[model samples]
Target: MPYVLLAAAIAAEVGGTTAMKYSEGFSRLWPSIATVIGYVLAFALLAQVLKSMSVGTAYAIWAGVGTASIAVIGMLFMGEAAGVARISGIALVIIGVVLLNLGGSH
Candidate 1:
């Protein structure tokens, strides 16, 4: 399904972003490679999903989910800050995404 692929793309994008943090300005070979590969796969899958989905809806969902997931991953694994405000913002983004999907379906 397109939605499943969109989720996969978001996950891949988050993985890529996390890897980028570990890349140390592109000096680390493995993490850099992972970042490149992950982003490429993410975009590819996103393009595939676009074939069946509205561009605006698909892009908004992709960006929202990817941003929220990446923020959580960064906080958990990259020692990034997880301030209350940031968490609350991410929660709002999730809520918006859910509402968007529900509204679009019916």
Candidate 2:
């Protein structure tokens, strides 16, 4: 299903972003390679998903989910601040994504 592919794409994008944190500005070899591979796979999957899905819907979900996931990852695992503003921003992103999907479905 296209949704499955889109989920995979989102996962790949999240992986790539996580790897980027460990990539040390691309100075590290394995993490850098992982980052590149993850991003490539993500785009490939996303491109496939676009064939059956609306671009606006797919892209909105992709960007929003990736962003929210990264923020949570940073807070929980990466020692980033979990301040109220940041959490609220993430919530707003989710809300916006939901609104976009709802609006696009009709």
Q: Highest lDDT: give the candidate number.
A: 2
Estimated TM-score for each candidate: 0.93, 0.94
Candidate lDDT scores, in order, read 0.91, 0.94
TM-score of 1: 0.93
Ten-residue region with minimum lDDT total, candidate 1: 97-106
Per-residue C-alpha lDDT of model 2 across residues 1-102, encoded as one tens digit per residue:
888998999999999999999999999999999999999999999999999989989998999999999999999999999999999999999999889877
Off by over 4 Å in 2: none
- Candidate 1's residue-wise lDDT over 5-58, tens digit each? 998998899889889988999999999999999999999999999999888888
For candidate 1, the C-alpha RMSD (Å) to the true structure equals 1.4
Candidate 1 positional error at 43, Å = 0.6
Clashes of 1: 0
